[model samples]
Every structure is written in C-alpha cells, then in structure tokens.
Target: MLQHIKMYGAIVLAMIFWAFSFIWTKIAIESFQPVTLVTLRLVIAVLLLYAYAKATKKFQYIKRADLKWFVLLAFFEPYMYYMGETYSLTMLNPTLVAVIVATIPLFAPLFAFLFLKEKISPVNILGIVVSLLGVMMVIYEPQVGVETGFWGIILVFVAVFSAVFYAITLRKISSHYKTVNIILYQSIIGLFFFVPTFFITDYATITDIKITYKSLEALLMLAIFASVLAFVLFAGVVRKIGIAKTNVFVNLIPVFTAVFSWLLLGQQLGFNQWIGIVVVVSGLFVSQLSRKRKISEKIEEITQVTEY
Candidate 1:
C-alpha cells in the first residue's frame, strides 16, 4: 500500500511537471529561439542525466546492433518532437499545445498498426474516434472556425507523429539498458540533430536573445523537472505497475496545463473548450479500455516509452 502511494505520488508529480513544461517552454522561448531553447534544454538535461546515471552506476554500454535504433529514437523525439512542440508554442497557447500533444498516445497505436503491423483491438479504434471528436471540440468553434493557425496545429501533429514513430523504434532498443542510459544517449544524439538545425534556423538571432531571469528559471525547470525528473518518475511507475495503469495518469496533463495556464499564464478557455478538455481526457481513459487477449498484449506496446 505504501509502495502504491509512493508510485502514485511520483506519477502525479510527473504529470504536474509535464503539464508545467508547456508553460515553461512558453516562457523560455521568450528569450531563446525554439530550436535554441530546445538544444540548451537538451544539453542541460543530458548532462544531469549522465551525472545521475554515473552516480547511481546505472549506465550501460550501447549495443552496436541497437545503435541505429537509438539514433532513430532521438530523431523522432528530442529532435522532431521538441521542434514541433516548441515551435507550435510560439504560435499557440500552452493549453492548446497541451491538448494536441496529449493526443499522441491516443493515436500512436493506430499509426503503428497502420505502418508497423502492430495489432490493436476494435475498442482502440472506437476510442480514437471519440478522442478525435474531443480534440476537434477543443480546437474548433461554430462561429470562429478553428481556434488557431493551421500551421500551428500541423506542427503539433508533427510532434504527435514523431512520438508514434518512436513507439516503433522503441521495440528495437535493448531492454537491458537503463532508462537513464537510453535517455542519455537520446539527448546526446538528439543534440546532433538540434545543433545543426539551431545553427541554420535560429543561430543568427542569438544576439537578439533577452536572457531574462524568468526565462532562465523556466528553462532550468524544463530541464530538471520536465525533461529529466518527470521522465524518471514516469518510467519507474511504468516498471512498477505496468503501462496500462500508469498511462492513465497522462490524461491529467491537459487538465493541469489548463489550470496552470489560468493560474500562471493567465490563459482561459471557453466553456465548450473546458468541456472538450473533459471529453478528450475521458476519451484517453476510454482508449485504455481493453479486455481481450490482443488488446492486453498490444497495449503494453502501444503507449509512450518516455515523456517530455
């Protein structure tokens, strides 16, 4: 019972951290370009993860056969995912960004089954339709049309697709590698992707960066709490209780993002939008409903391998 308390607390904290990540990235981007901010966050997170892994003696040498898989993982995640998510924040509010990004797990399995031949239950399909309807509710209004720019939504979907692709790559990685080790290599390798893009896209604007205290604080919070700590916490819960139970907590991210956006960022949603939040979260919970043999096995493979 005590262990359950700890794990539940840890996962809840992880959700809070991830929820705030959208807010933090919004603030941090004020001082840094999207890619620049992501690159720096990755640098800080990689260093901290490496240090922690070393201190705990949990580091593992990468297997050569798995080398390409790690590269691909970084490409999908810290590279494409961050780029999509961060750039979208430039155009969209945190709550909106959170809603779209939250759709990842809901839709990843559909993509995986479509692309990778992974199996899923009929219920998963129904849940995805419900989730998409909820997402549309959050995104559109009868009078105003879509709530944000088309490109912004498209970018967030890029993050979503990257995560979907990462789910495929995740299976190839050797399970013996510690989670920290996997993240370490991912961050390290992800930098290679980000650094070049940063130089090309945002480096010229470096001189224009404002470097305010709030931005720096937000950046550090993103690195320590969002990128590193939340991931470890979520991963621990996944190992302890398995993905089915632990993943349900991820639905809390949008709710927390909405609350924090109101409390901290002063963003508000319309009544229907709030309803959409509930609906989407409900759909996420609905997505997890699985009883048959196929869903029980495939679900363990369908969801996230890591978080922000």
Candidate 2:
C-alpha cells in the first residue's frame, strides 16, 4: 500500500509539474523562439541534474552496449517530441495541440504490448476511452472551434508517436541507470539534437531577442520542475509500474492544466469543464481496477499455499 501510494504520488506530481509547464512555456516563448527555448531548457536541466547526481555520488556510467538505446530514447523525447510540439504551436492553436497531445496514452497500450510484452486489459481500454472523452469535454469547446491545418495536425501527431516511442525506449535503460541519471544523460544527449537545430532554425531571430526577468523565471521553473525533477519522478514511476499502467496516469495532464489555469491564471471554468474534471478522475480510477484485482488474486494464492 505504501509503495502504491508513493508510485501514484510521483506520477500525479509529475503531471502537476507538466501542467504548469504549459503556463511556463507560454510565458517563456514570449522572449525566446521555440527551438531556442527548448535548447536552453535542455541546457539548464542537464547542468542541474548532472550537478546533483555528481554531488550525491549517484552518477552511473553508461555501458557501450546501452549507448544506442540512450540515444534513441533522447531522440524520441526531448528531440522529436519537443521539436514536433513546439513547431506545431506556431501553426496550430494551443487548444488543438493540447487535445492532440492528450492522446499519448491512447496509443501507449499498443506500444507497451509490442515492445514490453505487457498485456492490456479490457478495463484499461475502457478507461482510456472514457478519459479521452473527458479530455474532449474539457479542451474542446464547440463554440470556439479553432481552425487547424494539415501540417499542424501532422506535426503534433509526430509528437504523439515520439512520446509513445520514448516510453518504450525508456524501459531499455531505466533499469540499468538511476532515475536522475536517466534524465541527466537524456538531457545531455538531447542538447546535441537541440543545439544544431537551434542554430539552423532560430539563429537569425536572435538579434530580436530581448530577455525579460519574467521569461527567465519561467524558463528556470521549466528546467527545474518540468524537465529535471518531473522526468526523474516519471522515469521512476515507469520503472516501477511498467509503461501501460503508468501512461494511464497521463490522462490527468489536461484536467490538471485546466484546473491550474482556473486557479493561477484567473481563467474562469464553466460547468462543463468542472464536470470534465470529475469524469477524467473517474477514468483514472477505472484504469487501476485491473491492477488491484490482479494483486488481490496473487495474495489469495499465496495465502492458500501457506495454508497447505
């Protein structure tokens, strides 16, 4: 029970940090170009995580055999994922991007099954559908109806697949590396991708850059809370719970983002949005049904064996 509490707490907290990242990124992009912003975010996260791991004497060296796996993990995530999502924001409205991003877990079960041989339960499928419905309720307003282009939809879908593949690749190195080190190395290696792309894409725009204290604070918050700590906690949860079950918790991101927007940004929520939040929570509860019952059955078997 204690272990379950910790695992759930970690994932939920990770979601909260990520929810806040939306706000932070909004503030940050005011001063920095998207590619430039992501590169700097990676730079700061690498430095902070590397320093912490070194100070704690918990840094683990990567084996040569595992090097390719780490590279692939970084490619899937901070590289492809961020590149896709960030650029998509330029073409599409944030609401469309988010609703699309919220589909990550819907595709996760197939990847988890293919890569990790994890079984997907009917309840898990049902839960994902229900949660997706709730997400639409929260994010999709019939009145506003934001326009989207083909390229924008394509780019965000790139992000969705990148995230799915990232989770699959994470299982490759997560067991061998400490959570912090996994986040650290990924951030370090991610810079290789982000730096060149930054130069190629956003370099010309640099002359217009005027740094603001507010944007700096937002960037720093993104680095520390969103990139470093959130990745550590999320990686730890993935290692503990496996990808299919772990990704189910991702459905909470949009719901939490809405609530955070309401509270922090003074964005008033309507009745439908509040109802959507409740429905999203209910779906999360449904997804865990399989895990709980499977554990109970195992305990019964153990008891029976002891009686014999």
Candidate 3:
C-alpha cells in the first residue's frame, strides 16, 4: 500500500512538471527561437542524463541492428514533437497548447490498435468523437468570429500525432533498453536533427539574442524537470502500475496547466473554453473505461486458464 502511494505520488509530480512545461516553453521562446530553444534544451537534458547514467553506471549500448529504432524514436519525439509544440506555442496560449497535448493518451490507444493489432473497444471510439468535438469548441470562438489561432491549433495537433507515433516507436524498443538509456540516446540523436534546423532557421538572429533571467530559468526548468525528471518518474510509474493505470494520471496535466497558466501567466479562459476543457477531460476519462474493462477481462481469462 505504501509502495503504491509513493508511485502515485511520483506520477503526480511528473504530471505537474509536464503541465508547467507549456508555460516554460512559452517563456523560453520569448528570448530564443523555437528550434534554438529545443536544441539547447536537448543539450541540457543530454548532459544531465549522461551524467546520471555514468554516475550510476546504468548505461547500455544499443545493438547495431536496433540503432535505427532509437533514431526513428528521436525523429518522432524530441525532434518533431518539440518542433511542433514549441513553434505552436509561439502562436497559441499555454493553456490551449496544454489542453491539446492532454489528448495524447486519448489517441495513443487508437494508434496502438492500428500498429500493434491491439483491440480498441467501442467506448474508445466514442471518446475520440466526443473529445474532438471538445477540441473544436475550445478552438472555435463564436464571439471572435473566427477559429482561435487555426494554424496554431493545427500545429499543436502535429505535436500530438508526433507524440502518438513516438509512443508507438517507444513500445518497440522499451523492452530492449532501460528508460534512462532510451532518453539519453533519444536526446543525443535528437540533437542531430535540431542542430541543422536551428542553423538554417535561426542562425541569423543569434547575434541579437539577449537572454533574460526568466527565459534562462524556464529553459533550465524544462531541461531538469520536464525533460529528465518527468520522463524518469513516468517510466517508473508505467513499470510499476502498467500503462493503463499510469496513464490516468495524464488527465491531470491540462488541469494543472490550466491552473498554472492562470496563476503564473494570468491567462484566463472564456466560458465556452471552460466548457470545452470539462468536455475534453470527460472524454479522456470515458476513453479509459474501455481499457480498464479490457484489462479486467484479460485478467479473468488468465485466471480461468490457470485454473484449468
């Protein structure tokens, strides 16, 4: 019981860090270009992860055959995911971005069903439909007479799909590698993708760069808490409680983000947006019902099979 509590605590803590990451990314982008911020963030994460791996002697080399999988993971995640997310934040509010990202787990199971032949229940399908409606509500502002930041919403969805693909790729290599090693390699390979993009896109603006305390603080927090610590705690929780149960904690991210953005950034939601957030969160909860039911059924089957 105590062990379970601790694991739950860790998961919540990770969620808090991840929730705040949207705000941090928004702050960092004020001073750095999106690609530059992502590259520097990855560099910090890589150095921190490398030091931890070395100090603990937890390093493992990827088999030459499996190197491609890690490379692909890096491409989808720290590279593409960060690109989509950070760039979108430049155009969207932190709360809106966080709400969009909160839907990641809602879509992950669908991708799993598609790629891994996992069974998805009817409830999952309904949840997707409902959540998408909620997204539309959030993005559409009848008062403004336009969809709020349509391009930004589209880019945030790009991040969402990038993350879903990242999760899919992660399952392939997770069994073969430790979590730290996976993060370390991803961060390193992600740098390869980011460096060229940074130079091509933002190199000219580098000379005018003036770093402020707020931006630097945000960058370091993103590196330490969001990149390194959150992943470690989440991976650990997934190991202890299984992904379905572990993922329930993810629902709290947008809630936390909403509160943090309000408190820190003074961002406020309109009445319709609040309704949208509630609906989106409801859809997320609804989506998990099928997964929980499936897990229960699987356990029952295993029990009966064992008895026989």
Clashing residue pairs in all predictions, respectively, total 0, 0, 0
For model 2, residues 146-221, the per-residue Cα lDDT tens digits are 5656576678889878877776666556567776777678778888888888889899889999999998998999
Error of 2 at 121 (Å): 1.8
Q: Model 1: per-residue lDDT, tens digit, 1-308?
A: 89888989999999999999999999999898999899999999999999889898998889898888999999988798998999999888888789888878777667657776868677777778877887887876444335456678899999988877776667676455876888899899999999999889998888998899999999999999998889888888888888778778888899999999999988868898898888888888887776554422342443454646
* Per-residue lDDT over 1-308 for candidate 3, one digit per residue giving the tens place of the 0 to 100 score: 89888988999999899889899999999999999999999899899999888888989988998899989988987787888889889988887888887777667667767766778788878878888888777776543324448778888988888877776666666778777898789889989999999889999999888999999999999999998888778767777777667657777778888889989998877888888888888888887674454422332221110100
Q: lDDT value for candidate 1?
A: 0.82
Local distance difference test scores for all models: 0.82, 0.70, 0.78
Ranking by TM-score: 1, 3, 2
Better-scoring candidate (TM-score), 1 or 2: 1
Q: How close is candidate 3 to the true structure, as a TM-score?
A: 0.88
List candidate 1 stretches off by more than 4 Å.
Answer: 1-3, 141-148, 292-305
Model 2 alpha-carbon drift over 4 Å, by segment: 1-15, 88-103, 114-119, 142-146, 149-156, 231-253, 266-270, 292-308
Instruction: State the number of backbone clashes in model 2.
Output: 0
| Winning candidate number (TM-score) | 1
Error of 3 at 104 (Å): 1.6
